[model samples]
Target: MKIIILGAGQVGGTLAENLVGENNDITIVDKDPERLRELQDKYDLRVVNGYASHPRTLEEAGAGDADMLVAVTNSDETNMIACQVAFTLFNTPNRVARIRSPEYLRAKQRLFLSDAVPVDHLIAPEELVTSYIKRLIAYPGALQVVTFAEDKVSLVAVKAYYGGPLVGNALSTLREHMPHIDTRVAAIFRQGQPIRPKGTTVIEADDEVFFVAASGHIRDVMSELQRLEKPYKRIMIVGGGNIGAGLAKQLEIDYSVKLIERNLARAEYLSEKLQNTIVFCGDAADQELLSEENIEQVDVFIAVTNEDESNIMSAMLAKRMGAKKVMVLIQRGAYVDLVQGGNIDIAISPQQATISALLTHVRRGDIVSVSSLRRGAAEAIEAIAHGDSANSKVVGRAIGDIKLPPGTTIGAIVRGESVIIANDRTVIEQNDHVVMFLVDKKYVPDVERLFQPSPFFL
Candidate 1:
């Protein structure tokens, strides 16, 4: 579980802290001695101050023994080159690079099977951020869309709006209406954390919900609830850089897209590459220009400019001006929570999104505790509750009998072919898939034992 991270910038720093805190042996590499020193001071790991793409640098940082090498420097080329060095020179098993360019993204088809660009994963933050906003509009009431444990299971987040379909209905009552669904309400997050939802746990307006189901059930659940029924046609994206271009390409097949950028040269260049998208050359913050372009009638407005404040302000203006959905792409984690909680429908962080995607497959030993904290887009959590095995102390007990943690909500249990949502009297069957909310990684063992009475891991 040794991970070497290149670039101590926003994304790299966030990844290092989160992964290291999760008990992985992490080493951060950067040219900045001060950044490396600062990370070393804060966390318990090795920090190497050198160019990660150099052989001597990898030797100094011990990348030869690293389980994975992460190159996420500000420079996309640097990050890619760093990954190449990690793979070629250090012979690292896994190599991940942070690519912010649209050309590389579009070249993914060519690179997918090519060893020249033999990266395990390439993270495009702008694409991820814009897609989040697209998902919100595509599925109106659903609060989240998360792929869990290898995309076999999808976790959908929904908000119970006033007069919403399931308002004031019992979880069981709601399920009776929709038959043949291979999913469950799992755990409900009301008043916060996981609760033994009773018949009286009425689905109120704005009550955030997480539903775990098979991937195919996504459209079914959203369609039944009158959310995410119809796909979008027109999307207006502000900013013509990597994010806007990436979105334009990703969504062009289904939607008529427009991209606005202040830089005429870039806009003209983007226009040449994109066929379905119209590149507009104007200041995105300009109201007159937006109106001239019919921004109000658009289905989704994505503010993905490099400036954090501009993105937030533009998202607000887009929402106020009558765009159906607004999304802001931000690198800083601080603004994500504030904006999402305040008014922004979707807030996507490049660094966090990349980390969440990476962690979905990177589990060491018996630990299964990587989740999308979502800073606030959709809620996707992964946890292993106690089973009948030696590692799990509790089995065949009702959820009500377990000593649960604060801010944690149990969502679903994997029992054979079925993933069951819990009621107070719902018993924890043996070898169940117990999913919980807000469960911290540090106390995972303690939390695991709480479900089943056990002495300790022997």
Candidate 2:
């Protein structure tokens, strides 16, 4: 696909890097020469520097022949204008804009009601990252949230302790303990490639385990496997940035959030901005000071410090001090490898998450909304059904009859308001909103055909 990306900042730069996987003909446009230089140095792509709103600028950037134009500038106004120009002047097939002001996402339904600008998609990275924080709190053990088709199923990650019972046991053994919980252990990665764990494969201690389960039975599976008691009540956050503030505000309702910052001005700012959480001004790295605040009692310790090393060290310290779950946001790629199968529960990057979400929507035009889960190996796809699907060869045919590919399942058939888990007998009715759990990317079109009846097939 011929793609044009406006804004070569942190998010856009990251997008350009990830776009290499698709090997799409990509052109990045921005006003900063240094950032463009960095982008050029890093990725195999063309870079243009100028105002995206300018017609000649976009034309020079080859937006005219572009299949997609993505406006990911810091300013939402810039993104909105760039997308409009791409549509009206360049006639791009797809246009996406990233809006920072979160309220726009909330009022998107009414704001974009007229469709004045043909912005096909809108991304809010902060909102996306905040949702991650929410998911972590909701399920303390799971580092990543991978929701499957119809939101019926989810894949959660949990780190097993050194002397846990599940260790030295095959994941299949989980079924015997929790028979009622209908879940599967999809893939386990301990020493390299993803292993479809069998009855004989012994799970080692300190292994990061990824488990798949029906959404309803998620809790049951977690309780059965982990067995570690007590819900995480008190939490300590070691940053006062937007991510920290957003996470604090979102999680403060259920859990007691104590936000510690070194800057007095920033601390006061947080105190005023956030209502429920207690904002304290002090060096969070100070061991004595942290101890005075009873950091040892903190059930969940989150290190979202601006510096990657600080966050890592803080989280490690929290773990040493007996914090149940520790999560850190490590932005740099090199450092990410350091935490792989390491102590910290999760090491997330805001930039990576944002760029990833944008790229996900860029690839998934047919899927109404898409979230690439399990580190982009699997996709949670929501697509609308057409009449052709109901009259296809697969229709009235049991799933077993058709060569249903591995790791692919019909998550739910959303007829209306209700979410229905699909069974072999369940028919794909026309105009149904079909949600699918797709593992192989090549079979997306085939999966789409399964929902939409094709006249040729019947």
Candidate 3:
């Protein structure tokens, strides 16, 4: 696919890297020449340096022949205008714009009609991140939770900790542990290496485990791998920025939420805006402030400040101060890997989450959801299998009969209202939402091709 991307920031740059590897022609447009040069030095893609919303810049970025235009500049106005320009001038088939402001998105339903905005898809990173954090809070022990097939099925990642039922037992014992619920252990990562899960494979402590199950059965399955903590009640957020504020608004009703902001004026604004949350004014990393707030009693401490160092410092402090679970938002890839396994319970990359959401539209098959697992090294995809055996490579075939790429495993199938855990004899029918886990993401294109229906049907 020929794709044009606006902005050379984190989201756009990461998308370029991901799509270029999938054999797509990617062209990036940005105002920062240095950032453009950096991307040009690393990946095989075209880059145009100028105001992204300008028509000349879009034309230089090959918008005329582009199959898709992704507008993700920092400015929401620039992104929206770029999509409109691409639609009016170039007639790009697909236009995806990343809009951050809530006001713009709230008005999108009424404002974006026909060619007014011309945005085929609107992605909000802040909204996506807020939803991501909410899921973690809702499910006490899961490191990652992703829904698929209209929320009928879920793919979850967790750490196997000591004192859990299945932590020291073989994978086959899961059925013995939970006789009624059906679940499949899709993949396991032991000491940072991918281990193909089998019935006989043993789950050691600290092993990162991935599993698929019906949405209702997720909590039961998760309890087997880790000692589930009590549902979160006392929550403390270290930043009053967009994500922190959004999360507090969602969690305030169900939990005891407290928000801390460094700026006094910003804290006052947040206090005025929030109804149930307690707003504090101080540095998040300050010992006095945390101690006074009773940080030791915090069930979950989330640091979402823009500065990576501040977030790391505050999260570690919270953990040492007896916070049960500490999650920090880190944008840099290296920082995420460094702190995740240590004191921090979870390290979230907003860019990775954003890319996963964007890839749902970029994918060729009838994909319903795409989740980046293990920091983008692996992916969990839910795609609809269309057509009959003669017309589709996946439909009307047994699970073992399909030619899946290496490091790929069929986890489950959502057929109509039923959820089926995939086995060798499990047969796939037309229109089934097949959930597959790929340990190696380079095989994504191959998997997408396998789910495509015959050209005659199109």
TM-score, one value per model: 0.78, 0.81, 0.97
Query: Candidate 3's residue-wise lDDT over 148-221, tens digit each?
Result: 99889999999998887887789999999999998999999999999999999999999999999999999889
Candidate 1: residue 323 Cα off by (Å): 2.0
lDDT of 2 at 73: 86
Among all candidates shown, the one with the greatest TM-score: 3
Of 1 and 3, the candidate ahead on lDDT is: 3
Best by lDDT: 3
Number of clashes found in candidate 3: 0
- lDDT string, candidate 1, 220-270, tens digits: 765544344346667888888776777787778778888888898999999
Residues 1-458 of candidate 2 have per-residue lDDT tens digits of 78899988777876776565455789999999998998898788999989977898999999889988888887898888888888888888888888877567777876643258577887777777878777767775665665645466666767666666677777668768777555656456565445545667777865656666667766676665565546789989989887788889888888899999878999999999898999999876678777888877888888887799889888887777667777888777567757845678777777666755675566633456555554445555666655444466454555446555565665456666555545556765545655555555446555555555555765
What stretches of model 1 exceed 4 Å from their correct place?
Answer: 105-121, 130-134, 148-152, 179-182, 190-200, 219-231, 365-371, 376-458
For every candidate structure, what is the RMSD over all alpha carbons to the true structure, in angstroms? 4.9, 4.0, 1.6
Ranking 1 against 2 by lDDT, winner: 2
Clashing pairs in 2: 388-452, 388-453, 388-454, 389-452, 389-453
- Compared to the true structure, candidate 2 yields what TM-score? 0.81
